[model samples]
Target: MLRDIDPILSPDLLHALRAMGHGDEIVIADANFPAEGLGPRCIRADGSSASDMLRAALSVLPLDTFVPDPAHSMAVVDDPDAIPEAVADFQRIIDDTADHPARIAPLERFAFYERAASAFAVIQTGERRLYGNIILKKGVIAP
Candidate 1:
């Protein structure tokens, strides 16, 4: 086991994160997401919940600051303004990882799928709850 890595980050997940350039996106998705048919690559944190997996990923990867909406979550159906409890959990996780609160964009279902399709990779989690998916953009570390 690597001393510094999150145990959930298998070699493939590390490779995907390493391959990503600044601003490339990754999604830590709910169990119900179609992770298999998505992304050029997929990694399974088979026993972990999406939010837990997301928290682990954030322990390593940095969020992109080049874009305004570096984080994204699915919007409540038919109520774009409503924040799901799962999304609120995501906000808190990001806020703690970042220095301040993250301004996450609530994407419509289809928009979220589009973003997922283009992501560098998708980390599919075991979370069974609805609206548990989250997207993160990769950021650079200053040299």
Candidate 2:
């Protein structure tokens, strides 16, 4: 066990977060997400909620400040304005963890899937909520 590290963060997830460079993105996906067929490497966070997993990841991974939007979540299908309960949970976690208040931009299903495929890695959580998927871009640590 490492000092001060959230036990929810598996070793593989920690490695991926550490290996990612500034602006590299990582997706914290729901169980329904097509993570397996996506191109990016996938890490399983089975039995964990998406919000819990997101908090664990954000504990160590800094969000990119260079971009106007460093956080993203999948928008409800056919209802872009709809905010799923899970997405709200994700936003709460992001707001609490980020250096500044962060807004989680909503993306259409296909766009979200495409972005996930191009992310540095995907952490598939066991969260059963629809539209629970969220993407976070890594940022450099201040010197």
Q: How much does each candidate deviate from the true structure in C-alpha RMSD?
A: 1.4, 0.8
The per-candidate count of clashes, in order, stands at: 0, 0
Off by over 4 Å in 1: 99-101
- Global lDDT scores for all candidate models: 0.85, 0.90
lDDT of 2 by residue, 1-143 (tens): 89999998889989999999999999999998899999899999988999999888888888888899999999888899999999999888888987655799999889999898999999999999988899999988899
Q: What is the lDDT of candidate 2?
A: 0.90
Worst 10 residues of 2 by lDDT: 93-102
Task: Give lDDT tens digits, candidate 1, residues 80-141.
Answer: 99888888888888988763346889999989998899998889888888899999998887
- Overlapping backbone residue pairs in candidate 2 total 0
Name the lDDT value of residue 60 in candidate 2: 87
Error of 2 at 113 (Å): 0.6
